[model samples]
Target: MKNIIILCFVCLVTISDTNSSSDGKEKCEGIYVRDKFHKKVVIGMGLNRPYQLAYDHHNHKIFFSYNIGKDDEDSFQIGFLEKGHIKHKVLKEVENGFAIAINNNDNVVYFGGSDGIYKQHLKSNDSVIEKILSHQNIWDMFFKHHLYFIAYPSQKLYKYEHRQNKTIPEHQKIIHEKIFQFAIDGDEDKFFTNETGLYRIKNSTDHRIFYEGPKVYRAIEIDNKGVPHFSGQNGIFVVNKKNDTLEKIAHVKNIFGLAFDNDNNIVYSDPHEIVKLLPEDC
Candidate 1:
């Protein structure tokens, strides 16, 4: 009877493994979403759960942050893919977080680390990485009229005046909730996301909730037409201004970060791949 029971248990384990394998195959090996204006292309592979994505328009490259190893043994590093190149290049291994910002006007790239933010000139012959902001840990950042970052620990938003090397006073209290990421529209309207949902603040006016959802991803961007799009485990979604409704554009799985390239194409990252959404005709 003991031997018979052992054989039954083994058979059950085999059946479970087969079902899990079939389910995974069904989830990953099919077309999940469709769009007329866009076709997806896989540009990166074999990555370790890449998180944030930033495009350098001046250099025509896409930079991404990911871990060098699995949990506990993992270290953060920034990698980039040059236009028309299949090879991935290591930009730098940061000591801390995975936030990256590019100042195309200044030809510089800024990355967040344990100390603060560090800058590297993209065009300069000198390949030195210099620390620009220290003491304050950064979660995520972006550059528009100025440098803006979500501070670590507090999770509040702050703007830095690089020219004067000081934090903007009025921007210190823009919102009450914790911020994860943000984007400024063409009209200078700011959109932020956190645990609660997406928020918008315009012209120093009161913050308005645009979408109420849980745990939106850190990736968000405004297209050239000023439409804001963000991603999460569900898929990529866009905010419809006509009636303030959320629309899912791509049904891709586990999208984590997004950025718009110079030609207005959308580039996004998932667990181990970077893909671009391009016009179908091309």
Candidate 2:
């Protein structure tokens, strides 16, 4: 039954985590990526293209998608950074994937591909279930607040509420339009980016515009302070609601993915080079 599958999935991940540790330290401890922000750290020179990043705090893993806009069979790959370095053999090759997210609770990776969104077991490197929901060709997704919100090119939104049967959770069309990238803080307030501008969704329903300009925002991430920060074609900017202006934070260009680390450090990428923003630098 579904309950038994859930139990086995959890146990396997836990055992894998336990076995991957050494000297009372996580296998990833001391093997973090060196900062490559705004610099020419071309980790993507060998790949086709990369986009979307998901950091799994529970297992100290980084999941990402590459080879965007390619055919489902040969265009995309689901990759990860583990044991303090890039590990190509960890996860199986995926097709038509544009974005990815990690369920830290279950040690699984949910990815959007040409067909639809699928959840895969990290420990076994096997696709756990076929097709989590509808909306073919998922462009992006986020696993936050116990819900999986995904977007499509046609401006459709789909979400799956947290449940034991995540592989087959009932999908809901909650948001009527599309969101390029999104981030949610502890307050459940979501900051999103679209073709028009940067926006905010508060109280789970009330939507408001944050910034509207010529800049095409690419990444949306919230810091520990409840304020939202964005990266885009120009550079990185943080919300300064008091002045109704976006405070420029970093001058990097073309940030394709963004997230806040456990220590509130910013982790982002140019869709090629992944970097961590340290407190001293930011």
Candidate 3:
């Protein structure tokens, strides 16, 4: 999934790498608002192709994977924000470092690249990159009870169990289509999204469509209380847990990655900067 063009759920729109203004501020375009309002703020700047944000609740930092330069000159690196500064220490650059995950319980951050999956202890003073899985191309991944990922080209879901040290196909049921990204709610309810819509797997037997909006949602994230947020071309949308309704929260253009900080604020990326969407009242 190199240089893949992601589409929105409601309509078709394409995103570019640069959309800054003449005065050096990034211009947010194609905004479509709804009932709720959120103030968008740029938390970090000067990045290239930042994708897939994972938040560390313990340290309250956002870790992301990005590429410098383009095409043949591309170099992959992992970055994290510190004290509102773009401070990043490259753990170890790998081939196509596109996926990133952080385990708060183990205090470890995992990086998935074309070569394999590598992990580094976050709280250690002398952290070193250690290869956990090799020779597998990982496109997008996340850490729950285990590592859940969508392997590129095939686009099927696989689970990597750390305790057993095994990678196996999701044996509960068979997914017929390609899956993009997935998230588990606070209740440990598993949900996934594909070309059609978002689906929930209940009791490992019932696979049903949860939401049918956005034909091609790129990123899906859940907050601390199990509320789900989706990102596409239009903006960020949230599924309300109390009333079971979908509402547009923020209208961000070309939003790449989706994440929720410890405070439940939305953190996402555009082309060249990382943005945060916070509630206006908060």
Candidate 4:
């Protein structure tokens, strides 16, 4: 049972603390993330059950999903982080939160849930959320060239283009089975992962199996040069666009969320703590 609990945590669903302190803050474990020097530091705490993360390097902000239910509470939440402060709002309408994407044109973050996709103006005084699209369960989303490519677990995919100068979205449809996470390359190429392999979508007509193996992998995190990295059963692995080969970065497992800054510094969270795989000390 103990191992099962840890596996469930690694598989993405998480449990939360149910108490608040006299300071009017939620009583949970302190937030700890390893810095670029591979040094661990306690940053902040009181998050319910922090899950998938999206980093906005252009704005120096982070967005994540968490459980908001605690001690008679009954909601899930999405959190925004900026300048060491976090503000979370309850997502009462979203049933299951899965993915997040940041749009460079507007600098707004879009969140995917079981029911629909939603967005809000970041750091706005009036926090009104706008629904982008409705689906049964949105698994992941990616933004490229003023458009969003959304993944559905029901073996379908859709493209939403921001029209009228990013105000209205025109939706288009496509079907690709088992596709999960995707990232756009500098050449407008798509590098996506699936249930059993890594694939590539290029030239608007080619869907080719780039790599397939016995091991199950998580979503793809691409760097500035279009290199993809992931953390899964074999720890963190990298797929370089130049060679398209799998390279293992670390042996640690149970990585929940992973992000890469421009310098190729890696920050990821396990079930217990966040860690950074800094570039080799040169």
Candidate 5:
């Protein structure tokens, strides 16, 4: 009887494993309420490791950077999903790379890889790789009013003016001197970074601690209203520039990427899913 009981337990374990794997294989479809707590919209396949996500309002397409395998060795591709169809084009074939941004025109995509910064033009069907200032790894990039902002793990901020075509040092005033991620305000006057703490830079002013918390991954200015919203390990927090109030919007395990659609829909990526959260009334 003891052996029979043991055999039954073994069988149960096997069945459970099978079910878990099956669930992982099943593509999550439609919108789901995360743990039944908040509404979520899922897009694309179950991504094993998604590096970044960007939305192209011009084409109504969502782009995803996916890395495959243990050291990210197997595959690295930039894919787009639109109108229920998914298509991908290889940007890199190596492991451990980063995608910075997709140009508003959807004609150029910039990414940082183990080698260096790469620019790919969709129209010309060509790619150019250039070495940026640091090899420590670039985390993100944002373009505002012809100025390009590059964030690096070294906590340094660099800006490149399109007209001048040169990298300028913009780190002398940053508080922590170590920046993890950042976002530029639409107006080009203010920008926020996630370093040892939340820091904001404007008009050459040095780092000013705005909020203190775990490392932040991404930030976005909502509605061109100057209210800065950021995503970190603790969840999403919003800072009201006018009132100087910081408040939590929602909570998730980890946010890897963030983008706001034209309709004010907040789209972000958590571990295995891409979620879109609309305001309660909407």
Candidate 6:
């Protein structure tokens, strides 16, 4: 059944590539944020190569990956900052890593690279660096029901069941040639992605398109009111699931990462600097 699905997906990819004109030429505008009162609190410095971002809800901290140099072969480092603090602490460094996901415990983090999947125990400073599956370049990772779901840009999905000590193919229902970004809601029953526009996957077989846009890099499902917040080359978009409306909240030209805190604050990082979106002064 899975092989059949992969074959069908390959056919679709060929068709889409032939029909489409270079993945849409529209570039995102308004890439910076200035307060209504003209206060520029956040700034983008442009880093070497930044990738995934994760929020530690329990400790109110945000984590992100940063490359050391311009070369794609440069080493990458994982760092985190407190909710209201601007300083960051480098947690770990690696040769090549991306698509990182921090466990709910805020102590365990999972990431993938050209090699395979790995886990880091933050508290003990010990890591379980093992290759779960070979030849899979992971683009994103998230936890659902204690199981780790990894998305590979090459249209492959993997689930690592901790209890079973095994990795298996999952998300057989999604049929996209390439998936740029995806976000798993806390409940694990629903997820949003930008494979063929923003889509909500209710189950392995049930799903719906929330909205359509250019290729997206990252996304998060906001619990404040269930808004589907996403970032791409253009800017940031907030999808109102209740009314099915998409609003362009802030325009950041190069959005590398995004996360939301328990207090409903939004945090994002470009290349060099990280910024937070705070509510208007009350």
Query: What TM-score quantifies how close candidate 2 is to the native fold?
Result: 0.67
Q: Tell me which of candidates 1 and 3 scores higher on TM-score.
A: 1
Query: What CA root-mean-square deviation does each model show from the true structure?
Result: 8.2, 18.2, 11.8, 13.0, 9.4, 16.2
Against the true structure, whose lDDT is highest?
1
Candidate 4 wrongly placed segments (more than 4 Å): 1-37, 40-49, 67-76, 85-95, 123-127, 146-153, 162-175, 203-207, 212-214, 262-264, 276-282
Error of 5 at 192 (Å): 3.7
TM-score of 3: 0.77
Model 3 Cα displacement at 191 (Å)? Answer: 1.9
Alpha-carbon deviation at 168 in model 5, angstroms: 7.5
Q: Candidate 3's residue-wise lDDT over 130-234, tens digit each?
A: 887886888888787787777877777787764466554452245667788877777666778887776766535655546646766768887767766788766
Could you tell which candidate, 2 or 3, scores higher by TM-score? 3
Model 6 CA deviation exceeding 4 Å by range: 1-46, 58-61, 71-77, 81-93, 105-107, 123-135, 147-153, 162-171, 186-189, 192-195, 203-205, 221-227
Rank the candidate models, highest lDDT first. Answer: 1, 3, 2, 6, 4, 5
Which regions of candidate 5 fall more than 4 Å away from where they truly are?
Answer: 1-38, 71-77, 86-90, 93-96, 105-108, 121-136, 147-153, 162-176, 187-189, 213-227, 279-282
Clashing pairs in 6: 28-234, 31-251, 31-252, 31-253, 32-251, 46-272, 47-271, 47-272
- Candidate 3 whole-model C-alpha lDDT, 0 to 1: 0.72
Q: What do the candidate models score in CA lDDT, each in turn?
A: 0.74, 0.61, 0.72, 0.59, 0.56, 0.59
Off by over 4 Å in 3: 1-37, 71-75, 87-89, 162-172, 240-245, 280-282
Candidate 4 lDDT for residue 225: 69
Model 5, residue 74: distance off in Å is 11
- lDDT (tens digit, per residue) of candidate 1 on 1-282: 999999999999876676454334312333234434466788888888777788887788788888887667757777889888866888654676578888776888889866688878888545788877778777888777677888878888888774465544235576767888887877677888877777767756775757655455657876657667788776877766667667787777777788888887878888788888766542
Give per-candidate clash totals: 0, 0, 2, 1, 5, 8
lDDT (10s digit) by residue, model 6, range 118-200? 77665543445545555666666766445345555464455664347655546534544455555565434355564456666
Q: How far is candidate 2 from the true structure (C-alpha RMSD, Å)?
A: 18.2
Q: Tell me the tens digit of each residue's lDDT in model 2 across 1-282.
A: 999999999999897778464555434222122222222223223444446767766655666776634445446667766636643332443456677876666777787776777776766534355556564777667676554555555645556664574544344444446666666755677676666777766656866756754357766655556657777765667765565566676666666767655666667776456766543321
Residue ranges of candidate 1 with Cα displaced over 4 Å: 1-34, 72-74, 125-127, 162-171
| Most TM-score-accurate candidate | 1
